[model samples]
Target: VCSPEYWVRHVREAVRFADGVRALEAQGVSRFVEVGPDGVLTAMARECLTAEEPSAPVLVPVLRKDRPETRVLTTALAELHVHGVPVDWERLFAGRDARRVELPTYAFQRERYWLEALTSFASDVTAVGLIPPTHPLLGAAVELPDADGFLFT
Candidate 1:
């Protein structure tokens, strides 16, 4: 069901997602992975593909309803890898002794006035924006340098 806020905010751009998918398709973006609570946009995305694409782009989901989380994720990752997406294998192995290599070239360092401007970089707000309460993952948001966007978790 659509909410009143959604009707107001998104009715103007009801085809936004499908249009975005078409744009990506035009740019030769064939692989799509919807990393959400479940597979919501897969069908709509598939529908957006054009016949000129040679083949419909591979679409995968990270989550599914009534399915084991780990199993679904692993299968999706494997499918993506098979379809030529370069996922970092190192992400699967955590807390292991990671080997580091030193660079042969010397490094250059530069100082910034902004670094000394505030005790906490997070406190400085260059812009303020509101994420609607009806937003899927972000119920609210405040940009911070300490973290990427908001912590929906």
Candidate 2:
């Protein structure tokens, strides 16, 4: 699972990796295979490759869905077959099982009183024209950019 903060920080990294892969495709790299538990990276790779080279080679993911081991392996083999890659289904499906584990639960709740206080402070800052309305961080918090004017100093 990726958080908004994680996306904000690594989006540029993803873009850079895509650019490099696209360059490789320009040099006759035919196929791009993304092997991982999830296909999020593959989706990003498709976006990058499409932007750089529309006719690039096939982008394949080893795991197509979040499911039991059997389903995951079956989907992977099917994808390979669709791409004309031969595989031993028995060997691939060997030692696969559906394992279940308990996940922890948290009972924390948001502090409404804190949120209200922050919102009120933010309104005051906005009214004073300290931060522009178009600023990306404007709606996230209730703090003036330079409440003490130390930023300019």
Candidate 3:
């Protein structure tokens, strides 16, 4: 496909670039890193993705003409990292005194404790032949031999 005619035809014909992006999206690809001089391709990919989709793909631009090269690349890496992308932190921070810090758990975590309530109230107090006090408005427990159990008044 290196022939002059092939190159000419490739440039002349309308390419299905957006279709290719959508195909990638269909393949469960939710992250795209554009390693170009600018974010033109990233912007185009963003446009190709539909807004109705629940989870949109993350588009990270490696470089920008107006921004510093290192700054742009680092920002892109940070963006990817924040979007659940695995990054080699050690490699990136090589030759530096960077140490990984364990982040503390959230103050008000939303995790479900899912503790099952006690279905049966029969405890050791009841097992020892003594009826346990359960009622909130009950006074001192009084054992009634006729009732065969303690009654609250």
User: Considering every candidate listed, which one attains the maximal lDDT?
Assistant: 3
Which run of 10 residues does model 1 get worst, by summed lDDT? Answer: 144-153
Q: Per-residue lDDT for 2-65 in model 1, tens only? A: 7897777766655578788889988878899998888878867888788565455888878877
Q: Name model 2 segments beyond 4 Å from true.
A: 1-15, 50-56, 93-153
Candidate number with the higher lDDT (1 or 2): 1
Residue 123 error, candidate 3, Å: 72
In the order shown, the candidates' Cα RMSDs to the true structure are 17.9, 19.0, 23.5
Per-candidate TM-score against the hidden true structure: 0.50, 0.40, 0.56
Q: Is candidate 2 or candidate 3 better by lDDT?
A: 3
lDDT of each: 0.67, 0.57, 0.74
Superposed by TM-score, candidate 2 places the C-alpha of residue 98 at a distance from the truth, in angstroms, of: 18
Best by TM-score: 3
Error at 97, model 3, angstroms: 3.3
Q: Give candidate 1 misplaced runs (Cα > 4 Å).
A: 1-15, 52-56, 95-153
- The C-alpha local distance difference test score for the whole of candidate 2 amounts to 0.57
As for model 3, its CA RMSD to the true structure in angstroms is 23.5
